[model samples]
Target: MDYGPVIDFHVHLPYRYKDPIAAADYLVKKLDEANVERAVVIAIEGGVESFKKRVNPKYVRNAVQEILDYVAHSPIRSIRTLIFEPDKGIDEHVQLLIEHRRRTEEVVKAVEKYPGRLYPVGSYNPDYGVDKVIERMRVYRDKLLGVKIYPTLHCISPSSSKLYKLYRFVEGINGLVIVHTGCDPGLWELPKMCRYARPKFVAEAAKKFPDIPFIIAHMGSYSAIMPGIYFREALQAYNVDNVWMDTSAVDPLFVERAVEEVGYDKILFGSDFPYLVGFTIEDSIRDILKLDISSDAKRAILHDNAERLLRMLGRL
Candidate 1:
């Protein structure tokens, strides 16, 4: 498609690349392959420890039941354990620590190595102590453009008080927030959790902190069971001046609707790297190019919008 000047707004470190240096190198290679000029790599820290307050007993029980419910409700062919490995970024205890440490190092190294071609974004769960999240954030403030938060995975609402301080922190630092909208896969796929990922949740935060920019990642994209139920919900965020949406792991059909509803200026291109199926970074770029919108709109989504954000964040 030759869609150049791209800025992938959502991505995460893969578990396979144990070494941060190797991971950074590999990412650059893939970016080059897809001709992506830059990427915002999300540092996803997943483990029982990552659970708010170190896994409350009630949370564990609910998680287990949710998994069971998911299994019982889904078509066997779709979610069979052998094929349904939805824990994309979660790691075991030690691995989580190592991966986080490596992820930070990787982002730093990637930026130094590629020079303005990669941006880092830290992840936060409000359930985790706000101070602890802040402590982790301070280390990356100099290097990070913003924070990516998971309401669906952590089973908390975006409007929860726990996230406000973090929002304030990001605002104080002049950083953006990437709110995961839509359904999560695997054990984390409870309707309750996914419900909070809709753009409505982000609107609450935006209303409270109008200065902080919130990008709705996935635009309330849903899993098969729900099927675009929240996508429309996400589009409603267009009313909130500080809110925007990213097209990561999102369908082209929804992207079209997003342009019509939210306008292309608020849409950002995102690959959600290491995406399932054969969805490569190139494919993600192609999806935008294939949208039934103007070339200027595609350009805005692919590069111009993200460039504006990076400039605002002082990353460019």
Candidate 2:
């Protein structure tokens, strides 16, 4: 019943802030210590402000590229994504960014460089008209494998009117969608302005778009902030299919609740990684392993679910 390779599906590689390799290596060591076989790493910084204020989005590109290179030469399998920040990488005011062609080109090169090891996870601001965003997505549908959304920061609901068409487009597509759910340590000011960042909104989205595969990171935003809200979202996930939760941050209680309400089938392993505090990827997995869920469920959550998801996205 032992899942040979523990796959942490939700991990962040240091893209804009400090040293990416240092962050990657730190997680690598933790993964090695935990005997995790593979880890999926994502980059932060969607725009110029994130680049100018906090971290550089280019670092995101480099992080993915370098992580892929390391995976190619090393024994570990590192899954990487091409980040698309609608505000910075794309047009801030428009639903679709103007530099999509250039962005798509970079994504194609990155994927080609790593072959099966690298994949592009397109990001869109749902606050913009969903139709326009979907139109943009249709252009790269052939090349992209997944989609990412940040409803919280964008101050829009997952089911926002602006994103209805986008949601439909995403549901119709074959790739997976990873949503940002959790308290952002860097954006403390956001809480006052955005309330839809709550997991309930995500849960409702899951209910509305039952077919669109969704991975709610940060245990519905528990480990990071709004501890109570995380539990509610986890509880709500149980009502819908095609919606799963991840151990994106350090929320052991939320993990335990996810096991209880959604069953292990609905949980996927994750670690926010470089953005995390004192904990490492190993710590996150260890917290989940301590749950009372069965070994089969654990195996599925830790690796199998992610493996199947990756294959579905053509990354495998």
Candidate 3:
């Protein structure tokens, strides 16, 4: 199949255990090897740090140090989403906001340095109150491509009213929302929170903001687990125009089901790189090519959809 240009819609630039420049070079090398033209590079400071601490408090320092290292590195033209979590005690909440702001600034600087290569996305913990959430949104409004929310990681329901403000801002700016749906192996310690990552909540949000593009990352499946609850919900939202799904670290079987249910135009290919150890960019792209779908469908999933979306946000 001649899958034209490939675009990895999901990937991470973690600020730990690697030099940022080397990390960017490594990712670019993998993309080149896979024949991928572009990729969305998400910043993994705030969200992952919280989840890491939940798994083991010892991970906190390492997480912080890595992110700091990333900020000091040069920029690569990848989408940057600054993760934030406000669901904590007073002191902890304040500390998270401080760190999130600093990271946001770092991403902004990178975007400025790299020009068209980097796009920012804002994240907010709805529990922090709408006022604060809007305040954070304004800080990144001029520089962002959209916002990212982790309902499961923060233990907040996607349909909560608190998120509406952030959603409204994104819609007004013609931006997209990338929601973490499905279970994350890293968050295994909090299985209860994983339940909240279901795609149904995303469906509800999709219906409310019908015009805003919402990407359900991971396709609601985790680590080869078949027929995850998110898979069913994603199928349910198949008719919703703005609702889309990305195959990032998901099993191939689930990707087949997603293509079968929603068709190819709505699906996007993502590597979920760096975090999904052992899986190279080539591996991620190969997984899609190996599917039974046609050349046209594979083309859409591999590049067309993501390219269209990035163009919509003026990132292309």
Best by TM-score: 1
Q: Candidate 3: list runs displaced more than 4 Å.
A: 1-3, 17-26, 45-102, 126-130, 186-191, 223-227
* Candidate 2, run of 10 with poorest lDDT: 93-102
- Among the numbered candidates, top lDDT falls to 1
Which lDDT tens digits does candidate 3 get at residues 1-316?
4455688887755444244455556656666777877767664334544443563333333332444444223132110112122132223533443443324344444445444554555555534555775676677777777777776556566777878887898887888888888764322212454667777888888999998988888877763222365677777865678888889878888888778766878899988876678878878788889998877888899988888888877667
- Candidate 3 or 1, higher TM-score: 1
TM-score winner, 1 or 2: 1
Residue lDDT tens for model 2, 1-316: 2336687776554433234345445556666777777665543323333323332455435433443443233321111112344235322322222222123234433334334433456666433345655676787776566566665445566756666566767656666667777544322212432355556677777777776777777765542224555557556765667777777764676677667766776677877665577776667677767777777877888888888877765557
Extract clashing residue pairs from model 1: 52-127
What is the model-wide C-alpha lDDT for candidate 3? 0.65
Model 1: lowest-lDDT 10 consecutive positions:
82-91
Error of 2 at 14 (Å): 1.9
The runs of at least 3 residues in candidate 2 whose Cα sits more than 4 Å from the true structure, single-residue gaps closed, are: 1-3, 16-112, 126-139, 223-225, 311-316
Overall lDDT per candidate, in order of appearance: 0.73, 0.57, 0.65
Can you list the residue pairs that collide in candidate 2? 16-56, 47-88, 91-97, 182-221
- Count clashing pairs, candidate 1: 1
lDDT of 1 at 252: 91
